[model samples]
Target: MTPLIEADGLGRSYQQAGEAVVALSPASLRIWPSQRIALVGRSGSGKSTLLHLLAGLDQPSCGKLAWPTLGPVESLLPEKVALVFQAPSLLDSLSVAENVALPLLMAGQGRDSAARVAFALKTFGLLALVDKLPQTLSGGQMQCVAMARAIVGQPKLILADEPTGQLDQLSAQALLDALFRHLADSECALLIATHDPVIAARMDIHWHMEHGLLSCGERTAGSV
Candidate 1:
């Protein structure tokens, strides 16, 4: 089967005060349909940087990247690949329902956008807060809303960065349950970046990141 995304020695770096600072070491991996992957690392370990490159949010400084099954990089968002950031990233002016509906609207699914948004919110137990604003909700609620937005379009892949950082254990588990339910029997794949060992254990594949380098299988000693 064709991989949803494939990266060959992909890496990123930044110029810091006339010095080259490596954010990500050259790393290669493939994300297949229906795959469950956990990117385990501590803060500043390049987990977010790698996710950004894979989601086409940041340009890689080296190696190659491709979306073999999803399509071109420019056309991979809000339709083929969705992102849930560490922060909630909701528009304060927009209601919860509207926040969740934005992706569908952007994808030109305006006709049934409300229905889909409602369904997504319901999945995250946010249906009652549909009319609420971002500032009015708690941190966990906001994260749930962000998750609802990510799934509203039913994209092929979801890349989440530190998604459960602000949530309690129960809330985090509930969110994961909802996400897995959405992925069941579908081509959708999930790749989550987290420092939680319990969360990492839940996924089928575990990848480790440290000091900008990436590796599969057993995690490195003293990492995350």
Candidate 2:
């Protein structure tokens, strides 16, 4: 079967404090539909950088990155990939529903926006908080809202960077469970960059990175 996203010989580098630092080595990966995987690494281990490349949020310093396929025949633009950062990354002024609906609304999908917002709220257990502001919610709740907003547009792929990084243990587990439940129901391929062992243990596939190189783990039952 064709892969939903692919990256070949992908690498990224940035100059920090007068030193050229390589954030990611030459790496290649493929994510098929409905797969839930966790990318594990300590800070500065290239997890976020690889996630950016996978999501097309940033271009690789070298190699090819693609959606559905890895070439010009039909490579998806950044808009087709939904990214959820460690921070909520929500608009400070927007209401919960408005923020959740922002992507669809931007796509000229006004009629479907309301329904999408409602469904997302229900999924995140935030139905009553739809009118609340981001400032009023706890870190966990805010992250849920952000996750909903990310998926509202129904992109083919979802990339997350340490999504549960800020929450307590229980809250983090709840968030991961809700996220995996949603993935079980959607076609959105998942690539979550995380360091939590609890969350990493639940993934169908797992990869660990050190010095910018990722080693694939033993395949679990749910891995593609």
Question: What total of clashing residue pairs does each candidate reach?
Answer: 0, 0
Q: How many backbone clashes does candidate 2 have?
A: 0
What's the CA error at residue 94 for candidate 2, in Å?
Answer: 0.5
lDDT per residue for candidate 1 within 1-224, as digits (tens), equals 99998999999998989999899999889899988889987788899999999999899999999999878898988888999888669998999998888888888888889788989998888889999999999898888899999999999999998888888998899899988887787889999999888777788888988899898764344444
Residue 68 in model 1: lDDT: 92
Residue pairs with backbone overlap in model 1 = none
lDDT of 2 at 208: 82
> Where does model 1 exceed 4 Å of error?
218-224
Q: What is the C-alpha RMSD of each candidate to the true structure, in Å?
A: 1.9, 3.1
Highest lDDT: give the candidate number: 1
